[model samples]
Target: MPCDKSANADPKKEFFIDVITMDIDYPDCILDLIDNSVDAYTRSEIDDPQIRVTFGEDSLEIYDNCGGISEHDLLNTVFRFGGHVAHDSTDTLGIYGVGLKRAIFKIGNAFEFETYDGVNHNIVYENDLSEWKTRDDDEDGKWRFKVRAGAELDQETHGFSELRITKLKDSYKKMVTLDAKIIEEISIKYVLFMNRGLSFWVDNLKIEPLFNFEVLSNEYLQPSVKLLEKDGLKVKIVCTYNPRESLRSEREEGRYGWNVFCNDRLILLSNTTKETGWGELGNIAFHQLYYPFCGYVFINSHDVRKLPVKTTKNGLVTSDNTYKFILNEMWNQATPVLKYLRTSRLMDEETLIKDAEKSANEKVLQDSKLARSNADQKSIFSMNEKASFKAPDMKPKRKELTKIQYSRPTVQVDKVKRKLGAESNKKVGELTFDLFYDEECDDA
Candidate 1:
């Protein structure tokens, strides 16, 4: 038998657009643009990288102060679909190379790219794809692209890229209505980065991370930190459990649960996403898991092989064993603290205090057992250090002791040279006399 030929399954332009939008949410599409921004920043080695996502009435825009594309990148790969860039070899994000294009197509039928590198005044570039949105006859394989170069950009500053997408699809136009939702998503999605000085802005409102500490200052358990190391890679797990009452206030609405990160990028922010708590793939329910425990699993290694992130970089691959392993650890430590909280709540008033004390002791014992398997420094989370909720009631009894005093008799010398010893004496005009002596003086 002889094989006739090999064939390539090249997709149509429409199909390519569909593929990018099908599995993604609009918010995540915005994140794709940020991923490229981050990659650009990494390549340019820019300091104080800043990203702004604008929610416009008729358009959606994402702009970054990262270095603009170089001539090589612009000509060889910036606009090439399914193209691989040299930077991909590095550990920067957005490896698939179509994130920019996919995001552009998904958001609207028309888009314009404007960019400027800090140097090379003649290297500015812009590509307007407004006409391609209506051109259905040209197939993806035969379509061509030409980037138009322009003079110094309207802005005086160097090193910037601005992506503007307009002419939105009817349904996609609804993206503007997502300002409130995007604020929350960006806050959580980039909590790690924001806390580390990545400034993000929506419209004019700047996005900032929550308190930058590992544990809350309110009534919460001491953070449990565990570190796992194999070869040179490290994964850290830090967790804490707070009573639901602490979060009962409206301000704490979306602050409960896990906030997982990979190489300093937040994948899950505070378990706001139900997938991390209770969902089809999740075996644990938020309520059933005691309601207010959050764990942060961080992969210190930037190596893609060790980092547990889905293609979107917004979540972990639930099916991956290592991912599941981290989740399991989070559950294992969190379950006890939550159970303790629930148990304390359900106990009868008469037994609540005693039960709580007993539970605290038992928790410390369990933590001690866990401590055996983990090194003090390299563990994901340290086991519980005593009961975190118990308060001390000082109770020390006072001691009763007796005291004794001793005195010596004083010898008194009279002016006429007679000496006498007195048990008690007082001095009057240079003469020492006992109480009896005063009476004797009165008699004299």
Candidate 2:
């Protein structure tokens, strides 16, 4: 009599699936697919990179004219669970091999992935997740995607990888139905790409950048752009004011705060928390008082492993050494702007309005073209490793000023204001004071 010598130690595919897709949101699943397409574009020699996403009530379609998956990669690496094949030339956003499979399983039960690399290569892989989960493995007892060489694709689909997902999970269907929000998310997340000749479309409508990543740069006022380089990584930080926005009131609109990018993809947008050093010692707490603040931090490196971003590419690896250095630099660069914002509030209402108008018209950099035009100007100054333009110094108000206040009947106040031909109560008070000074004080 012998006891069972071994136990069932094999890992279930279901366990991996649950772990990978559990914490990810529906929109994030969509973004993972797009990140794969963008990585393809980055690694290819394609002249024009275009990605289109079409949403249906129960289905999703994403197509990209970036170079498609190679047959070698298709058979070896693309469908693998959790390893990355290094490409020396391309720095891409995909750190984990799970993005594609995770997205497919997160969105729907059925999927079709087809690719044509614009040469002689064409491959297609389609499967139902539920059946694949229950079906026995191949003779080799290995789980794998069954891919085959397919018919030559048409001109539109040539050089493109297309994915179609059906049977959308009930809980995730709302993400596709609310297409407008998704489009905005794409516009924000891919802003740098959009600026650099990448075209993205959703539901046949061309997507454009909804948020302008510009700041005021001129003779009177210029943005602070600081560059920090450490161990082959380059970080460029720009902090300044947006001429069109104000700090007078709180705004829930995701139009302000820090915008952080890694390898040209936006990882954080309008981030206003301690995670980005908002309430740190050197930086002011994120309040409506600092609403006019706009910042951009771009981190670029040839090694994707060095970038301080998680596998989701939606947040930072805050504990990363590079990120720690970046956080300190962000604080140092942001201190002056915060000081200016705080001091600017001391100005009187009229002076503040005039300053706003002047900044908007003469001093503000109107467009990206103007921003570039001023690049060679002497206004931009560099110190050591950081390059910056000086923020404006507000003229300090006189400390001897006094305020006069009194309550009067509404009828009397209006009548006196009319008699004095004044538009405001303060004007009427000023006129009455001057009359008394001339008639009584002078005669005395």
Candidate 3:
């Protein structure tokens, strides 16, 4: 009897490609690549950081004048799937090193990286990617980039990286459309960077910092610090609430929420609902409340494991205790302001905050401190079903059934497989996911 051992092997090329491209659309993929460029600026502390994106008929490219990649990083870091990087900087957006590579595989079959530092200019790409994986281990497996004195790089932009994704894959050709929602999301996500002198351009058009909904009545409550001893977490919170008339009640919870940031990068764009921390604490019906609210929680932590984000970097795990503390803090200050907004009914937002700030400070501080203590586990302001009159649960009476069941009618679905129609390289009658193209952008 003998124990059998399996040999280690590289993942098959198609499986690797498919896994790399999962769970992200074109807009998110493009944004991931930009995150790397932003990290360069964060690391180098470069002033006047500029990111330019261009749309080509059959290709797309991203250009940034940040720090350029070196030979070692080009070969080992950038091209390597699942390239490992440690979470070294709290301020930098990049943690996982797979962003740029995944983005490339998402958009096109082959892409080129053109970069220049003060001394060297470099270019790298691999054609026929599938061939590399099939090559025998004994054959030379080394693949390195080409470096030269001048690589079509401008002298003025000495230190920079330019990524061009070309030869569009059949599945990703519609990425060129550039939807309005994508632009709005980018503008909101990067407003702080834009304010700090980073210029972001999309297809020769400059993206402006999107403005928040106007506040009617407001209050700048005393800032709060909550220390969760068991978790070793600290949250510093500042909050503002809109007046009763500021937001349309009919419009519901439209954009009234927390804009949470960790080390200055936005983690949760809008934490605006009961599950997001407002439900039990605020007590007021979310959709019925006249006043809208928003706030920020700047976090400092002893343990990086407690960070309130997923690897995708799209949003916070709002269910985490850290976010729950923040939402609760915002609600404590918001209660009095909402009460005033209802009774006083002020037209001017400025005067409301000024007035609320004077009266709410003491209560806000006491509640915030008490929340951290084990002695007072329950928030006094929060509502219980018995104390606050919640409607009694009544189960619906079951309908009597006797010989009433019948089988559903059979519906036939026509499934047709087709190839791309008259495409230069594709066979006739190629089928794509049926996306609706007739609907136009509201302004377009």
Candidate 4:
């Protein structure tokens, strides 16, 4: 009893113990790495940061000229689990610490990293997954990567870091063929920013800029409607009808408008689909009449993230009040143009033949009246002193009317029904409508 049993208890047994086993799967590893590259490039304050992605048969390397990690920082923090030098307070792009490790683990079975700090010259870290399997089991598992002092390079200027991932996953190999195209598209998509001096290269291919819109001065003069404006956000609508072409035929007239951008960089180009609510209106023909062209509403970068973009990152402005107001303003301004397109499409059909025939008949009567007036003027001139006699039928005969047989409207009723059906599926509530009947009808 005098031994003080409580004081004799083992310190280890008295202490709390916690074991965490985290298993995360990374199916989209390469995509995550590319996003990380974008983050690193965008965060660096360098005038023009260069990001190089090289793909080889069994290895992949990504090198960036951004600030490199120090040897001590790398060992003590960078390689540690839950390590994030950049956190929520940081405005930098790569705040999530798990991205790099998960990216590396997904693409390669083994990976190595080399970073340069002016003071240390070069710090190297290598991780071989193959060796982890052979290592002895222990209370504290051995760290995944190896870190050591690296050969010194000249410290007069800042240097870059290189990440080499070997034992490449099969998907990485397929990406080698597509990397060039991806770089080209990315370059074009971000051309405006690219012009500001950001450069990205994949293998030997350099990305080139492709701008979508020309300068404002280059746009043609057309009636336009202004919709919404809040702070820096502005929405303008424009509609134009081409009388020379038929809008009803898909091959002739192409519908335009509805593009989404962030900071003048286009994120999604077109969002029209049958599944979308926009396709539902039977009055789309009326809408398209003004549709040979339409203008887009511009939302500034600050509010862009608020937009309802799909999981695929496709942004769409729906029939909500915000969009409805804009559409109403646009539709009011476009009513005339929409009528024009509808009339033009209608005039091409056989049902409008009666109207065409009436127009032709009016022209014939007008010509006859003109002829009688000319004849009376000639008679009056002949009565005047010694006027030369004029021929009665001197004017040329008008050409015979060419009977044009217009085809039936080819209404595409099924297509319209299918489109409406799809649109109805998107509706959240029930619908009610009133039916009108003739007073003379007694039959039920």
For each candidate in turn, the TM-score is 0.64, 0.76, 0.64, 0.50
Tens digit of per-residue lDDT, candidate 3, span 3-33: 6977868555667667868987878888788
TM-score of candidate 3 versus the correct structure, residues matched by position: 0.64
Worst 10 residues of 1 by lDDT: 415-424
Model 4's number of clashes is: 0
Write the residue-wise lDDT of candidate 1 on 356-442 in tens digits.
Answer: 354565443433333222222232233423223221111112226454343343332232112211112322212233223433554
Q: What is the lDDT of residue 192 in candidate 3?
A: 62
- Tens-digit lDDT track for model 4 on 221-314? 2333344554434554434422223324552212243334433444444334422224444434323323343333334323333343321222
Off by over 4 Å in 3: 1-4, 7-10, 84-90, 130-157, 179-181, 212-235, 243-255, 280-285, 288-290, 299-306, 319-444
TM-score of 4: 0.50
Q: After superposition, how far is residue 140 of candidate 3 from its true place, in Å?
A: 8.8
| Stretches of model 2 off by over 4 angstroms after superposition | 1-9, 45-47, 153-158, 174-176, 247-255, 346-385, 396-400, 403-444
Tell me which residue pairs clash in candidate 4.
none
Quote the positional error of residue 267 for candidate 1 in Å: 3.0
lDDT of 3 at 243: 35
RMSD of each: 23.8, 10.6, 17.2, 18.0
Tens-digit lDDT track of model 2 for 345-418: 32323444465465554332232234334353431223224546465444432346677788899999987754
Error of 2 at 427 (Å): 29
Q: Model 4 — which ten-residue stretch has the worst lDDT?
A: 428-437
Clash pairs, candidate 3, are 216-349, 217-243, 218-353, 418-429, 418-430, 418-431, 419-429, 419-430, 420-430
